[model samples]
Every structure is written in C-alpha cells, then in structure tokens.
Target: MLEVSAAREIVLRHAKRLKADFTALMSSSLGQVIAADVASDVDSPPFDKSLMDGYAVRAADVSPTAELTVVEEIPAGKMPTKTVGPGEAVRLFTGAPIPPGADAVVMREKTDSPSADRVVIREVPTAGQFILRQATEMKVGETVIPAGTVLTPATFGLLASVGKTTVPAYPQPKVAVVATGDELVEPNRRPKPGQIRNSNGPMLTAQVALAGGLPRYIGIATDREDVLRSYIAEGLEIANVLILAGGVSAGDFDLVPKVLKDCGVTAHFHHVKMKPGKPLLFGTKGDKLVFGLPGNPVSSFVGFELFVKPALRVMGGHIDPPTATQKLTLSEPFAANNNRPTYHPAKRDGDGVRGLKWFGSPDLRAMLDADAFLVLPPGEVNYAAGAVVEVLPINRTAS
Candidate 1:
C-alpha cells in the first residue's frame, strides 16, 4: 500500500496543465486561470479627474482664507467650461474632470458660496490635492493582469476598467461522475432489501464543482464487466476526469480495475494507507484522469479532498495551491482508529475543533455539520479535550 503523500504525489505527476486557451466573457471567468497576459486598452482616468465634490482652484487663491469668483460648475460626466486663474475657482462634483489651470481642490464644507457668482474659502489648499492625474493608475498597453493569474472579482473589475468584455482563459476541466453497483438505486426510487441509494454520484458531482471543475453526472453502472466497460468508455470520451464510485475494493464484484485497464487507462496506485480511503484508485489515459473511489460515502468524500482536489488545482494552472489546514485544540475527547491515519468529521467550535458522533466509513450522517476534518495519526491514543490537532477546512473561498 502507498502512503498518502506518495499516492498524492503520483496523482499530481499525471495532472498536466491544459495549454489551450479560449475566449470567455469576463463575467464567466471568475475563479479561472488566464491563459495570456492582458494589456490595458486605455489609460485609467484617461484625463485629470476630481476625487471629491469641491471647488477646483489655484493653490495660491485659497491660502488659509480667500473669496474667489466661481467661473463654472462641473458635474460628473460634464466638461468644465472655464479655467481657473488667480482668485478664481470652478465648482466641481465628485468624479468630475479637473479643469485646466486648476491645481488643487478645497472641499465644499471648507468653503461657502456667498452668492451665485462668488465663493469663500476657509481652508488652505495644496497643489494636486484630491486630484487624480492622468495615467497615474494604469497606462495604455500596460499589463493589467498577467498570464496564469487566477481570476477573482477584483481582477474582473480591473479587466472591465480596461474595456475587456472577453478574456483569454483556460477552460475549467469537465469531470464525469459515475456510480457503480447493481445494488445501487437512484434516490428517486425506493430501494429493496440489501440495496442502497446511490448517494456517491451526487456527492462527488458537488465536490467536483466546489473544486472549480464542471461536473457531468453519469448514472449508475452495474457490476457486470460489459456494463462497466460501456460506462467507462462513455465517460472517457466526454470528460477530462472520469470518477467512478465503488467496485474498487477486493471482492468478486470488483470489476472496475480490470475494465479500466482494458480501456487503456494505466493505473498509478491502487491502495493508500489512510482510513476511509484505503481502496482509492488513480489512473490516466492520454490527457484524462480516472479515479475509482470506494463505495462508502465517507471514503469517497475523503478521497476526493485528499487526492482529486490537488490535481484539479494543477490542471487549473496553479503553481502551488495552499493546503487549507490549521491547528486547533480539541473541544472533546476522541478515540480514533490506530491502524492507519484517519480523518474524522469535525466542526469548529468557538475556540477549538470538535469531532462529531460517527461510525467508521459508512456513516454519512456524521458529516451533517462538518466544516472540517480532524487529522488523527496512527497510534493507540486517547486524546482529551484541549489536545492540539490539525484540521483541514472545507469550502474554502476562491480568491
């Protein structure tokens, strides 16, 4: 059996970044990677602009106190009709263009308009105060967002500022989720004895989307080799990653590994020494990845977070995605499995992490309020409250 780190490393070795680029609307590119550097088409602020609603005047005209002639009023989006000379000012609102010959802006609260054509200044003004100069933020043809940058709301805003309606970005990988087993039935149908609802398919689809991949759900595949082959062939043809839940453990019905090999997928690793995810299988063919996850819902859940998410990051153009782990004290005592490292479903308390009431691998109810998983290393250990432990947070924000 491979160690967790070793298995993960092997998975990443096969995760090649897709080099092709496609044009997509800026609004749809959030949380995606840019394929090429994007340059600004126009200078930011293009002209001298005002940062406040005030009088634009010569600095010497408002040294502590002065009364000045109000030449014109410049509202936002309206050009100034008059230039301010000595003892003169232009009334300007926020975001209005700074008029010619105006060097400073004194806030309206600091000055009073005694008459329609005249104004009084009560505060001194300095040169360039409240003035946004042309090209100060960005120049035309400058690189606004570099290549391989992960798109965020702020980045999209920046691109919009440069008049970019579309951007060259890498497409999110399309993942196919397939559930296996003749013992499985869709949630819409009531299951007979010795049968179970196919929860892994929907759960894995959600996981794929959360990791920034587009998920396509393929219905359950039965245990027969012919049925498995048909589903596997369809998945491989349509998606960049094919994820089949179950039929991976050593059993008479364990037909996924053999069928996948026949379909040209080279298996990288078959087992990992981790609780709940021991029978995780990873393979590749051409540019696509295939994962055969254990049938247990919690095992499938843990397997995706530990093995698949990192591969998605690399394929999405991240050089080094951070592991979302933190150290916290345990809020309650826990007695975990000692044969292998286990990740117990946990919730964040006010000042610590607390494990939930759980039964080994098959207990999906334990994950109801779980926001993280507490990592328990292999040992015959009884941890008391307040014992420091590491946890991996789920549903991390995209930045």
Candidate 2:
C-alpha cells in the first residue's frame, strides 16, 4: 500500500485547474476563487479626507488659549468651499475632504465655540493629525486582490470598492455522489435484518457542498454489476467529479473498482497506508476524476478530506489546495494499533489536543466532538501526555 503522502501527491499530480469564466459579483459569489489579479481603478479615499468630525485647522495657528475663526463647515461627501488661513479653522465631519491650507484637525470635544464663527482651542494641535492622506491606503492601479484568492465577505467589499461588478473566477465543480451496497437502504426507510441505512450518501453530499462543490446525490447502487455500472456511467456523464462510497475493499461483493475499470477509468492508486481508509481508490478518465472510498462512514469521511477535498480545491483555482495542518501538544497519552499511520479524532483542550473516545472506523458519532485529528505515523506508539503531535483539522482549514 502507498503511504499517505504518496497517495496525496498522486491525486494532486492528476488533478488540473479548470478554466476561468466571468461571473457577476453577488452573494452567491462567496467562496469562489479568483482567476486573475484585481487592480484598483482609483485610490482609496480618492482625495485628502477627514478621519473624524472635527475642526480642520492650520496647526501653526492653534495654541492652548487661542480662539480661531470658523471659516466653513464641511460634511461628508461634499467638497470644502473655503480654505483655512492663519487663526482660522473649518468645521468638518467624518469622510469630508480636508480643506486646503489645513494641516490638522481639532476634535469638537477639544474645542469650544463660545460665540458664532468663533472657536476656543482648549488643546494644542499637531500637524497632519486626524487627516487621511490621499492614496495612503491604496494607490491607483494597485493590486487589491490577487489571483487564487477566495472571495469572502471582506474580499467582496474590497472588490466592490474597486468597482468590480463582474469578476473572473473559476467555476465550482459539479460532483455526483454514488453509494454502492446491497445492504444499504435509504435514510427514510428502516433497514431490514442484516441491512443498514445509507449514511455515506447524504454525508458525502454535504461534504462536497461544504468544500464549495455543487453536489447531486445519485441514488444508491446495489451490489449487482449491471446496476452499479449504470449509475457509474451516468455519474461520469453528468458530473465533472464522481464519488462512489463502498464496494472498493477486497471482498466478493466489493465491485466498484472493477466497474470503474470497465467504464475506462485508469486506476491511480487503490490502497494507502492509513487506518480507517486504507482501501481508498483514486482514478481518472478523460477530464473527469473518480474516488472509490471505503464503506465505513469514518473511512469515507477521511478519504474525502485527504484526497477528494484537495482535488476540488485545485479545480477551483486555489494555489494551495491542501488543508493546513498544525503541530499541537497532546493533552493525554495515546497508542496506535498497527504500523500504518493513524488519525485519531481529537478536540482542542485549552492549548493542547485531547483525544476523544473512538471505537473504530464505523463509529461516526465519535466525530461529533472532534475538531481535528492527531496524526500518528508508523512505528510510533506509547505517546505520553504533553507530547507534541501533528494535527489535521476536520471539516475546516487549520489556522
């Protein structure tokens, strides 16, 4: 079996980024990756503006006990009509343009207008205080957002500030999730004796959506070769990426790998040296990619995170497709079963990681309290408390 890192390298080597397309800037654009660098058409703050609603004054003319003439009042979004001279001040609100000849601003709280057009400077003012200089925040034609950047709320605001109504971005991939097993039934129906409701189908669909891919839950495929072949062919025709849960292990009823080969998918790797998801399969045919995950819920989940998630991210034009990993101290002692690397579900406790109660690969409930997985490599066992370990965050990128 291939090591975890080798498997990941193979998947990334086969996965290629999709073509860029123009998309309108809307709420739905969130989480989409940019295809090109976005440059600002104009400078932010556009002109010399006010940072606060205060008096714009010539700093040299203001003293501890000097009273200045209020020459003009400037509100936000309006240009200043008069400039400040010696012993003069301008009443300005926030975001208003700084008037000419004004080097600083004295806040209203620091100055008192004892009479109309007359103001008393209670505090001495410094030059260029409370004023935002033009082009200081962003220069004209500066690159505001770079390529491969994910569009978040703050990024959307930045794009809007630069008048980017239509953005060029890589389109999200359409994923088809197919679960194969004769013992599997729909979630709405109770399973008969020796049968189980299909959890991998819904779980895989949700996982695809969370990774910014559009998911379609193709119905479950029975163990029969004909039925599995039909579903696999249909998935390939409709979706850019296909995910098949179960039927990849070395068993008589496990027939997904064979069916995928019959449908012309060249196998990349069939097994990895990792617990819970060792029977992971990755393949490609033409422009589409396929993942044959293990039947166990935890195995399927881990396979998607370790292999498929990065592929989806790469297709969306992310420069760094792999989810980030962190090194954290283990709060308690733990051990591994075999020589293969093990991913133990864990939670953050204070500043360290605490392993949760994990029964096996099929125990999906144990994952509810897990925010990350403590990765234990081969031949390493008998970890003591406070041992530093590498952690891969679950369901989100590590910070």
User: Of the candidates shown, which would achieve the greatest TM-score relative to the real structure?
Assistant: 2
Q: Against the true structure, what is each candidate's TM-score?
A: 0.94, 0.96
lDDT of each: 0.88, 0.89
Off by over 4 Å in 1: 320-324, 396-399
In angstroms, give how far residue 302 of model 2 lies from its true place: 1.0
lDDT of 1 by residue, 1-399 (tens): 998888988988899887757765655567788888989889888889999999999996676669999999999999887778988999999889999999999899999888988999998888999999999999999998998888888887887798877777777888999999999999999999999999999889888887878899989999999999999999999999999999999999999999999999999999999998899999999999999999999999999988888888778776555356789999999776568988889999987999998887899998878989998898776889999999988774443
Give candidate 2 misplaced runs (Cα > 4 Å).
321-323, 396-399
**Taking the tens digit of each residue's C-alpha lDDT, what string does model 2 give over 1-399?**
899889999998887888899988887777889999999999888989888888998888777978988888889978988878998888999999999999898888898889879999898889989999999989889998999888888888998899988899998888999999999999999999999999999999988988888899999999999999999999999998999999999999999999999999999999999987999999999989999999999999989989999989888787773867898888888876656788878898878998899998999999888888888777758889989989988775311
**Model 2 root-mean-square deviation:** 1.7
RMSD of each: 1.9, 1.7
